[model samples]
Target chain A: MVNLGSIWQNLLASQAPLQSMTGNATTMAGLATYSLPQLPYAYNALEPYISAQIMELHHSKHHQTYVTNLNNALKVHVAAIASSDIPAQIAQQPAIKFNGGGHINHSLFWKNLAPAETPETNYSKAAPSLAAEIEKTWGSFDEFKKAFSAALLGIQGSGWGWLVKESTAEKGRLRIITTKDQDPVVGGEVPVFGVDMWEHAYYLQYLNGKAAYVENIWKVINWKTAEERFQGSREDAFADLKALL
Target chain B: MERDISDSRNQSANSLTLSLSLDKQAVTMSASLFRATPVARSALRAASAVKPAATFVRGKATLPDLQYDYGALEPYISSKIMELHHSKHHQTYVNGLNSALTTIAEAESKGDFTKAASVAPLLNFHGGGHLNHTLFWENLAPASREGGGSPDGALGKAITTEFGSFESFVKQMNAALAGIQGSGWAWLAKDKAANGKLALITRANQDPVTGNYVPLLGIDAWEHAYYLQYENRKAEYFEAIWNVINWKTVAKRFEA
Candidate 1:
């Protein structure tokens, strides 16, 4: 396992007096930077549900922009911290949250999807424990799906819909939640799975038929990942990000 | 601490003096303030230091009144959509812009550059939304009046030379509108750098057209613009909007 804290210390050490004084926010050689994760399945794997064109652009164009922007913002943040520029640090916060959330959300979103008709896409076969928990909460698997779909369609603008496992007194309880504009699920909630509701997610193939997109997304949902996130700790669910570290 | 206190005093005094001046001047002053980059703004601040209590007028943006009724463009654009789009969405942007500007001014006075800079995205988003919607209202009229049909003057001749014909221009504009990946606007703009040649462009989210182009006609491609009326068939909304294009306004902008 990689030492995440040490990696951050190294990042700070590299941005010493010389680099900080120059205000050169560009990534230096040998510097650790956040990068776009490779998709588990081929771009065309989810075809007939999500088109290959939509997958390619969503991953390459949209997600890559988020990763690039997050790196740039983090560099500026590091420089600001070195200078003790409170205002500059505050200014970099929004970009960090927005781009950082975009990266985290897209990274998780890709892992939680599978090729249509696969065993991983079948809740009954791949996610028995999660299916049982969901059925217990919403009364049935179909009811949970209906409720989740309603939450997805309710988003006014750009956002995401998530199924999360509660970590409060109601530990391990299943819940459906929605967040606006690239906001990730926060606090102690384990994001079992999420669906991107940004127009770019479905606009190419679905056009303005958002309901159809919502309906079709289930066919590609990776229930195996959902079950794993449901059963594991938050650290286990976020292990993919740690791999990048 | 002494400098911060003096700065606040000067800012208040400037505000008081601005209140006594003409409203038009106040609007112009605020517009210029919003346009300046952080570096240019600090330079402006340094320049103003010589005259400690000079004019630093901050103005609030108000919603522009529509010449036609909310339901004027109905059947094509529903009264419900127009009312929500204008009263709810556009008004939110106007309020946000005013609040962001106020926050920046207050922050700058207190030497809180962090707060000032943090409000920059709100200023950009709401500012662009306010300006885009202001232009969009004027770009429409009831089909019964001076709406739809091709231009007949120099603007008409230019359209023919640039995009082949009026029909082709409409087709191309619709194509641009349909191609937008997310919430954005598709515009028919005059490319200032290329000697005012007509061009079709798209801006993602509420980003306004800047640099070398003067936007002449813009079609709102955000789902909010047509989702309630046309639903999934946004291609219909794109096609239907041409019936109320207000070509006279486009021609006036072209000539200007």
Candidate 2:
């Protein structure tokens, strides 16, 4: 339950400094113009498993639109912030979210993939900590993949399947979660690796067989990126918990 | 703070016979404050399937009449979107909920708990969809009418207090909305236990905001809500919707 009266009293008590503060600087200042990040490899790089044409369109067209839209929305958002117009700000949210999410997910997706020749089964060596956590949680790498793939296939629409570090609530565990429609994994969960399940991601290549796309994606999985994200998330979680102590 | 559930339920039952009949042009209802009680609750009362307006009241769920013309929210929310959303999308949910409830009611009557348990998801999804959309409709008005301005009176004061300012509140809600990972809704709900302090919360898919709080305003995040008018420029759609926010209706709900 929310105690609005007490909360209002608190706001009034702090109103002096709040009143003194200038136009919503945080909202307006230093807005990042998110650009289309370059794919680490050539369009044809993750071939056989993920086709060149798919990568080209997904990255160049789909991802680019998100970038352009997010930047455009932020301009209005900055003004909404300064004016203190609540409804105006609220109105801009959906655009920022969808486009921002597209940008974030695609950016992460591109980095987390590599050439097919890259070793697919080197999680234990590349990301020892993540591998140990996965092994402890799911018994082994094979079980973890099976679980992850099942979660991915279960998504009902255009979305991403993620392996995230649950750093809050459940704490320091690897969990498989699916977000429909480019919604980023939020609330203290740091994404280690993500698989795009949008039909546009594989329709041209895999046709209706989403499972085949999920299975084949492993051939181009970038374990090194996953390891770094895993290690960083764990460190961040530790710092957050330590602050409580 | 306890609601007179019986009185409210009775009121809903009394209104169960009323149904909207639209012309080919889709002009049928007018925005009036007397439709004070949540139509979502009134919708549930019609689930009895014994109502005179039984065409829509299938086993006890019915389509709510819009208080404004479908074209009333035009330029902000197109008449086409409102028509499709209300007549098709929301109606589908009402039908789904009624069907699910009918199934559950039958199972319960025959002591078939297993069958009842199996259809619970349908109830949660469709029932929640009906409830949320019902609230969604009541929370808007035509800008030319009594809509699109900031809140006033106690609701206004509460907004200022809890959120620092109205702009801050919208900003915070926007941040929350931006973070929902899928098809969902962003809500400005009142927390009864917390002295009516407002809270911003979200629900995934068709899940309703349940327990501890009453939803005062809900912004639908589902693509169907904006995909037609705004397309991928969801920000434009979201920003434009404020022109039709029914703050008076919101204040009334809060005071009750």
Chain B TM-score by candidate, in order shown: 0.82, 0.78
RMSD of each: 14.9, 13.4
Instruction: Tell me the lDDT of candidate 2.
Output: 0.69
lDDT tens digits, residues A64-115, model 2? 8877887787667667757776567567666766776677678778877888
> Which runs in model 1 stand beyond 4 Å of their true positions?
A1-191, A195-245, B1-56
- Candidate 1: the clashing residue pairs are A87-B114
Model 1, range A65-132, lDDT digits (tens) per residue? 88897778777776776676766866766666677778888999999999999999988999999998
- Lowest summed lDDT over 10 consecutive residues: which window, candidate 1 chain B? B11-20
lDDT of each: 0.75, 0.69
- State candidate 2's TM-score: 0.50
- What is the lDDT for A5 in model 2? 21
